[model samples]
Target: MARNRFDIDENLESPFDIKHFRRAMIYIRRQKKPMIVAFLLSALSAAIALSAPLILQHVVDVTIPEKAVGPLFGWSALMLATIVVSVVLATIRSRIMTRVGQDIIFEIRSDLFKHLQQLPFKYYDDRPQGKILIRVVNYVNSVSDVLSNGIINFILEMLNLIFIAAFMFAVDVRLSLITLAGLPVFLGIMLMIKTRQRRAWQAVSNKSSNLNAYLQESISGIGVTQIFSREKRNEGIFTRLAANFRKEWMRALRFNALIPFSVDNLATIVSALIFLVGLLALGPGEATFGVILAMSSYAARFWQPILNLSNLYNSFINAVAYLERIFETLDEPVTVSDVPNAKELPPVKGHVRFDDVTFAYDPGHNILEHLSFDVKAGESIALVGPTGAGKTTVVNLISRFYNLTGGQILVDGHDISQMTLKSLRSQMGIMLQDSFIFSGTIMDNIRYGRLDATEEEVIAAAKTVCADEFIREFEQGYQTEVNERGSKLSQGQRQLISFARTLLADPRILILDEATSSIDAKTERLLQQGLNELLKGRTSFIIAHRLSTVKNCDRIMYVSDKGIAESGSHDELIARRGLYYRLYTAQKMEA
Candidate 1:
């Protein structure tokens, strides 16, 4: 009644859950035809191997004793043929099983990646990237061999044991019983060791996950570490993580080594006992050399399968630990899936409405409460707010990145929740402060906005945002390779490239959250002319800290405490002398 190491109270199910095993079997079922062929080949190989002792018995007792040269030659040839047949069958079976394993790995990895893409943003927000990567990459690789080679090999070994046991009993039950006297002791030892071995392996897997997470975090933030002169401190942390991993790994290694060592010593002792019993039980007419030789061979064969089974069990335990992690990820609920009967959003005129909408990242702590507002088509509105006033949250709501806690958000009279996410978000263009540039050519990064855009179109879009002049100045021009996150480019240049990319998408609704904050005053003035022309017919929401950015906006709204504190044109708000006026005056004085 001892609790399993893997079981947790929250699971409410056994660690070795039937559902998880059944799901794994679904992947195996895909290659059922090849698996059946491999099974038959394994059986044939085992049968051929089982024939070796019988042929040796015949040669020792009959052919050699009679001095029959013809029969001796024939028996030798038959023995050689059995060896050849066993080798051929084993080789073919191995190839087939390898293919089946690789196929299952491909399918599982593909499905995991596709599922990750479909999962909502909140799912990623709650999990570390390193932990997710370990499940997707390392866990899948660990289970591959067990699915392909472990199960099939274990079955074949069991078949060999059964066949050897049957042959031993047929020859003489008394000797067979004597040869297997050590088996009960061996089984008891194995049972005692298995739980400890499993626990050690599980510890190893957990430590490996932690090591991977730390490495990923440190490498990705190496810049910050270097700038802060914390290289030695970070190295110390890494050494500690590595030491913990090595400690658990050594424990697992000891457990794995003990099984084989015990089995080998037991086999030798058992063989010696079988030989002694054979010698004592033999009489002039009662027993022949053939019987003694055959039983000796069977005793050796018997322990070989047990040894193989032990090793396979060790591997299975380790694999199951990783399998549990993988299945846990696969079972994560997608909380933001589309409605069952959701329809695609048609062409939109860009009118957005928030009616009594309330939202929170967690329960009982609202970020936006009963926020009601409407933006007219083709209007440019600027959101000016103090820090943490939820300006970004409003932009996220407009794009349906998170579901509202209460009420509804609508675009062109259709509730966004009732529309397919793809159809709803495709027509919206967003440009943020930290524009992420993928590792690719400048042209490739820009072309990502519209995958099928022609070269001329890409050039035109860059020109519209004044990104073309600097791009052409580079030696590689449009083909200039950008390092990860545009590390080689200045902040202003990265922002311009992002602008060019979003401009190429030609979205009807645009969201710019401090998009030009990195641009110098002269550059900002130059880009402002192009932006004014681009915003002429599009509905745009701009979140800005600078008063100059909102001065040209049709209306400016001051956001505070999850509600609009003031709303009007820049001039109108200045005349009203409220929160907006005070904020603008402070910025003016700082400038």
Candidate 2:
């Protein structure tokens, strides 16, 4: 399979669909109760606030002209009271929506992370790690406000527009029509900009994702960069990616900027037209001073919501880009999962069989074809092979990391495909070529193998794998903090700790692929001595390039050409002078 590099922008196969918004309704519905409360409070606040203009109209046209001082003061106090009440309600609504926004973010991120964990290794292998991290962390965060407050604000603005229009119509029909005459023109301009704006923002999202992917990859491989003395080259690459992101972001902002500019320009024109038409066209009799004042307030109020709607529309376009990426991750299929009728694997005596197994990472490119092998309950099998000869693939198959293209694998007379993954893998201990160490203390990392293991058991496992000697040299000993990938520990030390971790699991079947490749010969010898008891009654598969390492195994299989070419005890293979004998002799001469 072709793998994607950090610099490559991930292809978005589908165009922006209304379904993205519709799909968001699922997360929005989860917080409907809070949203409903917020909406009601917002509506109430808007309703109370609209009365301020009418009160001003009443004071200007009714009270002052008639010299009604008491009425003027009373209305003034009432207007002030309305302003306070509206502000309080709005504050309450803002608080509720903030909480709802955070909750929506949490749920989205949680779901995205959960789905990511269930995805097969192939899913991760195809994309850059940075791309996955950005979706779970950044993209999810970007859409929280859109999914929560954006939805409620959209509704509130629409309601506000309706209320303002109703008040204007009540004041004067002629002026109301004139005030609204600019809407069609504004909407036409928006329709023209709509596709351009969405496309630009989508570009922005893609550029940002690409930048993040490269940034993360560079950070993780910074040591490699310095070792190769390629800092300037990497810097140039980063500068190029950063420039692309900024360029796309600015382009999207330019389109977004036009929405408000169009709204404001049209609004000022309509406000001027409202006055001219009301005074000149309708005459003084139809347009009273109080009526004119109230209509002016209504016109301003009217355009305010329209401007808000334009901003919200901008937010939607931006958010849809993020939502597309987020939902895409959520929709990734779990290629390897338990069947509907799968059952938990029972405890076994460690009999494993590969029955004519055919497997491939990609279609028509079989790595292992029609291969059959069996190991008895307590036998030690060493797989010896050249690189790229299906050594690691064989071990990965036993763990069921990838689904088989053809054939079946059985453990203790039960098909592994019919077993739950957790139950199946829990009994097997696997140590791969890369001994990954997480960020934590030595004890904590070892305890990860058996969560319930006691401190004494952990120490014993470390001792059994010969890791205790080096661990004790640290000032913190078992408490020594290690960085991720165990950068502070030697390659051999990382392998020893990894070996200790595997032993702590006390697995029925243990697989070590290049388990001691980095360790010095003396340490490897000591480790071999320590493994004697651990291998007793436990089925083990050891893959090593060193012929001497496997000289004592019960059987050695020379794996090549998509199957085992030779299988026998070390002495028998040497006597036969076949592929295994030739390879063993070549290594012995090299030594």
Candidate 3:
């Protein structure tokens, strides 16, 4: 599969469905108690609102003609009290729904984040970081209201329609039927526009996601863009993405506009028809002035609910686009998770073995095919190889970052696959080429590897990696603050801190993939002096292009063509004058 870059829009696999709305109902169902209370309050509020037209009819038909001052005051007071009660109930309902909305957002975000943490590297490799980030943050946020109040409002609006229609029929059947006549027309219009509107909104969501992905990528790589003098090119790309988002947004808005337009016009035409037909067709007794007044009020009230329902339907459509993406993240299979009833691997002595191991990142193209190797406890193994010879893949497999396509890896004679990932990985130290440093003080960064490590232990780890001298030079020593990804520090400084973190773990097995490449020659020489003591009883796997760095290892393996091509001590391999010998001679000539 092509890498999903910032500019690329991933194909949306989820179709529009009632099931998607039901899926959001899962989050809503969790807050059922508050939702029930809020919904009851809304129902009561609507009931109170429905009484207003009746009060108006009574005043116009009886109270005004009688000129009854005391009854008018009483009725007026009752109406005012109902209004106050409705407002209070509405306010309470709003507060409850607001809290419920926030809770749903928190829960969905937490679940998405937790699932993302368990997702394998390939999941990340196949998508833009920005796309993933948007789902967890922005998309989850967008669906919160729809999952909460949207569900409530949808049900409430239906109830309101029922209540309003019943009252209209009670006031006068003839006018009520006239008002009801517009509904089928309104329903037909909605049916005509529904699929097109949903598709348009989905397009808007896609464009928005693409824009967000590119924006995040550009921000993260701003330094590179400036260095390469590609600012204009990036800006041009951003402009196009932004324009596409706006274009899709406007197109969707046009569809959204149709909902209200259809409802409003239908309501107006129906209301006019109600008055004309009632006056012309109905006799004096049937079409009372008070009945016309009440029917007109009911006519407006009825369409209002339909209009609100249409708006809620719009919210649901837009929200499904985001919820689909959110749930998709939550549903992403954890390819590298521990098996059911997986046991914790006991503390290992690092007797590592690869038994007929076959692996492939992509199908039908094995990087390692039926390959095998072994390293006993306290051994230091160095892997030297060409660019794509699976040196990094070997270390990643040892950490169980990816499941093997076939065969098994054993640690201390126990199959690693049977072990819990946390237990296995916690006891092994794997440092990669890019050293990621979190935003925190120097001491906090070093202590991250072993969070329970004491201040003294953290300081010792830093000193062991020769990171102490430069850390002390800072104004606050170990307290010195760093920014995200350690942008405040040099690449070498970040690597040094990373080294300290790895050492603090005090693992039985250590895998360093070009760990010391960033450090200056002088600092590297000093670090090696400390690493010698650190490596005393640990089984180490080192991958470095710098041939000099691996010269002292107990064994050197030239990895290529799916397995080890050469294996021996430095001097022994030199004597053989094979693949390792040629590689060493070539580097020596360059030096």
Candidate 4:
């Protein structure tokens, strides 16, 4: 397998449905037994708490009137025992809640990371790296918090509300039902809050993504900013993006804070009205001191539960939106993937044939139109044409980076599409015009081409491309540090290292795309001799501008608008006086 990479595009088209929530719920339900136990424990705890007011009435009405200190001490001991039992149960329930919260957070984060692996390359191409990283890190982290503590608190709050209501009704049914009449109003206010919460959370997500993208773009081009003295201008843009981000954050914060506070007050208001109604419904004689006190305590206990429910609604909205974004990326169809039942490519002699293959990045503009050609095993072919005349496109197709729009390309007489992309590409090697320098030591970059190559083999490969001299000159030699994008090396030197890396792979097929363009004439002359040796017993495709490059090709296929307008050795093409002849003569005249 290739190195593990996390370059998924988080802004993929929304592929979210009810299915993601269903998956998330699977983890939520695992704590069902514990939740049920917690519910019962909380109910008992609330019952014990309600007994406090009742015990007070008992002490006043029964114990004091009896004039017995013995009975008072006995009643006080019972109260102490109830408190102790409730405290223990409450402690156990809290621990269970914590476990459930932690487990759900782990599940959400794990599922999110797993989904990222199946996303397509086009997703990565479309978004900024920073935005994607933030989604994987901060956004996922936030959603996990919503799922964990948010859901646990929500469940416990509902249990608390239910038990408190039951206790109130037991005290005085008429007063309990009448007092509960304001429940509809409480529900209505919470529903309105939920609507605003959804919009606020959505805005927060969008703004976060934007801010991350802006930061990434600014930092990546710090070189350009420093060169043009545009730091002030870039800073202004960043400041504006940050300001907008803060506005979105503040909007979410205000609504979330307002909803919980409003609900707390609403519960308080509801409880106050219930007390007045109870006093009216049960006249002074009918309402005992014990019953009235217990009912009042239940009403106040209702607020904590109500506020928790409101906060739960707010958190769930954010989690759902986050899950939707994650699902969008996961569902994106991988544009390039192995075909079902694809056969592994057998060992090949490196013969390549393009049979009427056609392709275009966009419709109505073919990069290669009905392009057909074949090169014998161990033969060298040069593709000479103006830029974007399908030279690199043809090579890219052969490497299976992009599929052909029409026709078939055969490697060793078998269609490339029928072969496993990995097996087919393993036999080919490429050296591009602009080399990519990955952050590592020089030795690490070279080993990237062939991981199993030995140290001696690596040194030999560098020597083959005449790169060993400069490499040895460095204090660390092969281990010399190469910064990200190979910034430490010159263009010519990077190209030389790329050549050495490719040569070490010992591929059956070799592709050189303007490989010699970056170096000086003296180095080019020296490398031309090395390329001649390397080309032997290998199928070679050379895309070059130097007229001298194709001099030794077995056969030259001169690419042009007309497609392979001329073919033959160097001498034969000059006789034709076509595109190749004209271009060749023009260069000599300029010199």
Choose the strongest candidate by lDDT. Answer: 2
| Winner of 1 and 4 under TM-score | 1
Cα lDDT tens digits, model 3, 207-275, are 888898888888889999999999999889999999999999999999889999999999899889888
Pick out the ten consecutive residues of candidate 3 with the lowest summed lDDT: 1-10
Q: Score every model by TM-score.
A: 0.93, 0.97, 0.98, 0.81
Better of 2 and 3 by lDDT: 2
Report lDDT (CA) for all predictions. 0.87, 0.92, 0.90, 0.77
- Which one wins by lDDT: 2 or 4? 2
Model 2 lDDT vs. the true structure? 0.92
* Model 4 CA lDDT for position 427: 91
- TM-score (C-alpha) between model 1 and the true structure: 0.93
RMSD of candidate 4 to true structure, Å: 5.3
Residue pairs with backbone overlap in model 2: none
Root-mean-square deviation of Cα positions for candidate 3 versus the true structure, in angstroms: 1.4
Q: Tell me the TM-score of model 4.
A: 0.81
lDDT of 1: 0.87
Q: Itemize residue pairs with steric clashes in candidate 4.
A: none
- Quote the lDDT for 568 in model 4: 84
